[model samples]
Target chain A: MKIRTCKYFAKQSVKSIWRNKVMSLASIGSVMAALLVIGIFLILVLNVDYLAAKLESQVEIKVHLVDGLSDTIIGEIRKEIKGLSGVKDCVFVSKDKALKDFSESLGENSYLLEGLEGDNPLSDSFVVTLEDPRLAPQVTLAIKAMSNIENVVYGKEELEKLLDVTYFLRVGSLVIVAILLLISVFIISNTIKLTVYARRREIGIMKYIGATDWFVRGPFFLEGVLLGLIGSIISIGLLATGYYYIARYVEQQMFGLLVISLMPFQEVLKSLTVSLLAFGVVIGSLGSMISIRKFLKV
Target chain B: MIELVNVSKTFSDGHKALKNINIKIDNGEFVFLVGPSGAGKSTLIKLLLKEIDPDQGNIIINGKDVTKLKRREIPYLRRNIGVVFQDFRLLQEKTVYENVAFAMEVVEASPKEIRRQVPIILSLVGLSKKSNLYPSQLSGGEQQRVSLARAIVNGPSILIADEPTGNLDPDTAWEVMKSLNEINHRGTTVLMATHAKDIVDAMRKRVIAIENGTIARDDKKGGYGI
Candidate 1:
């Protein structure tokens, strides 16, 4: 084909977009809404999984010392534990400090502990962190056999529950993504088919005039892509703003100890834009092709 | 030149539209394809355009067998043939100039050539002043003229007009025929299909008349074979 002919078809494709204004708007609106919803869920799930992961990293086993252990013994235990490659940090907490901390956590129950409070029932021990949180059990076992250590307590149960939650979320997110993508394609295909049905006469004319399969189909395909692109942009913009407030409120009100990264706004937008555009382009083109296929006999 | 030998088109519903059709149209000949309604007139045109193919037969155009042509080669085949339709199938959104330029565009005519040939052809159809007018803005006769301009802009050797004057007043129909006659006089083959006996009588061109899907008469100078 000549360059001028290519330009003509390109122009015709653009004119076609305006020719069927209502259908075009409908396609773009629905695609945009769907993309926006999917985008929001994607961000939420990703961040929740990330926050859970951060919680996992912080999981550690606390090894308390026996009563009347010497300062030298405490120091020696700390050195030995730190020397272990998987151990991250080993903070030594005295019994008195532990009692004070427990009282604070106990809130109004502190009055009930008044008899035990002055005596400092808690023992001094190392609040041990591990380089690999999964090695918490092994690290605790090693510490329990130490001379001055009396007991070992950590977020063993909590970490296990956290892992369960992460596993569920990872699986659940994939299922949701798959369902959403399927829904997107189905809705888009129907939307494009309606557009094609409306323009059957134009298609007939194009075919009778010897318009190639691509020439007749190109504009509609382009419209589908443009719809997806515009829809994704609208969705991403709304998602970013909405996510900012949601993340801020969640961070402020919930446990700040396990803060979630909402992820940088720029990265989310850039990736969503590319992905949605690709999605829209493929879906739109596919929808258009499927819709117009019956009419493009020649 | 166009040649159709032993062409037959049967639909899935077991209706035969054309039967054992055989005809040859040489370059620079103006002919009329006439018949009653549903007489397989459109089917013949479709076979030539490959809009619908024949079940059995050969269609040779300019010494090339179109029956064996690839799917991609249809556009190139169309580049050499121009068509004016009954309803004046002009792109509704486009202006007269753009509509005429579309044929060239489909064939990839350069911008310089479009700028050069578009106006001269628009004038040939007597639509020079309406270059910027949309199809809806024009009268039925004027719209058909725009269609004519669009059809002939590519300077095709053969022009297939399927009932070109079907929707026009008698005066307008004559005007369209006059435009077609002028093109024929310029040595371009014109195959016009019409049920209007008056136009065929007036033109006195070679007429190929079909009745019930088979060639009934081929006249050197005829008037609708009435």
Candidate 2:
């Protein structure tokens, strides 16, 4: 294709789109609405995943030691736990320090532990954090077989349910996004079908005049792309504006109220713009290509 | 030159449009295809343009078998042939000059080439003065001339006009026919399908009359036969 020919195609596309302004606008609006919904859904899913990950990182296992364990045996137990694959960090809490912290937590009830100072009932413990909290059960079972290790405790059911929710969200959002994409393509193609129908006679004339299939199809393809690009840019602008306001509210009003952190506007903005632009172009071009196929048989 | 050796076509509904058509049109010859409606005149034109394939034969244009040409090669085949219709199918949105230039553009002619050739073709068809006028703004005859200019702007070796003057009055039809004659004189082979009895009798060109899906008569210098 010559540069002049491309210019001609672009000119023809713009002219046709302008002529069918109502139809073009309808397609653009469809694209915009579809993208907006997808974008919002995407933001929600990503934020949920982020919060789930944050909560996952905070879960830890408390390993309590057996009574009368020698100091060297407790040291050896800490070393063995540290060598586990998913262990992030290990901190040993001596019984004396544990008793002191327990008393502090009990506040005015510290007097209840005064008579038991000589024989502290609290077991010396190890606070174990993991790289992936989902591995808590396996790591807990492994630590239970260690010498002087009495028991391993973690919120088992809570972690399992959290992982299940995360898995469902990722897969479910993907299915929903795929369906939304199909709907967007359908709307766009139908709109382009009308444009093609209106100019069907012109297409027939062009075909008879020795216009190649590409020459006949070039303008329609460009028309679809233009519509997609315009719709994407508008939707991105609307989404960004909405997200910015929401992010501001999260920071100013909901910071202390919600434990889950909202992803910053700038973090989501880049990927959202890029993905939607690609999506719009794909939807628009695919729609036109499918709509114009039967007419080109001439 | 164009040749059709035993070309036959049957529509999907079992209507035989053209049966064993055999035509040999030499380069630079002006031939008329004459018949009533459904007489296979349009079918013959479509076959020559490679619009539809023959159910059983070969169509050769410029020594190449068009039936065997690949799907992608059809455009180049059509580029060698220009076509016009009864409706004077000029792009209504374009002016006379742009309409002619559009044909050249379709062939991907260079911008400089389009600029150089469009004016010459417009002048040849006597549409030079109306170059800036839209199709709706022109008289019926003027519009037909614009279509004629468009047909030849790409310098196709063969010009096929299917009822080019069907919608025009006698005088206006004759005006378009004069332009076609002039184009034929300039060394381009012209094949026109028509039903105008007086124009056929007056032109006295090589006439091939078709009826019932076959050629009924072929004459070197024929008139419209009763």
List runs of model 2 lying over 4 Å from the truth. A52-59, A64-125, A129-151, A154-159, A253-259, A294-296
lDDT string for model 2 (A1-298, tens) is: 6898899889988987898888889888988987898788778777766766777778899999898888888888889999999999999998999999878867788898887789888988999999988888899999998877788898676656777876787788788778877877777777778778888877877887777888888998898898888898999999999999988988998775466678878878987898889989998998788787744554
Task: Compute DockQ for each candidate against the true complex.
Answer: 0.42, 0.67
Q: Taking the tens digit of each residue's C-alpha lDDT, what string does model 2 give over B1-226?
A: 9999998999999999989989899999999999889999988888888778899989999999999988778888888898888888888888899889888887888989999999999889887888999999998988999999998888899999998888999999988999999999999999999989999999989999999899999999999898
In terms of lDDT, the best-performing candidate is 2
- The Cα RMSD across the true interface for model 2 is 1.2
Tens digits of lDDT, candidate 1, B1-226: 9999999989899889999999999999999999998999999988888777899999999988988989888877776788888999888878989888877765556788989999999888888898999999989889998888777788878899999999999999888888988888888899998988988988888999998899999999988767
**Could you tell me the lDDT of residue B26 within candidate 1?**
93
Residue B37 miss distance in model 2 (angstroms): 2.9
lDDT of 1 by residue, A1-298 (tens): 5555456555655665676677667667777776776676667556656556777878877887778977887888889989886988889888888888778767777887787856777788778888898898787778777776778887767656766776776677677666765665565566666657666766665655567777777666666666667667777778778877776776677644434456665666676677766766766666666656644444
Q: Is the docking of candidate 1 incorrect, acceptable, medium or high quality?
A: acceptable
Fnat per candidate, as a fraction, reads 0.32, 0.65
Model 1 misplaced stretches (Cα beyond 4 Å): A1-29, A83-85, A103-115, A131-137, A144-148, A153-157, A170-194, A250-283, A294-298, B91-94, B106-108, B132-140, B198-204, B220-224
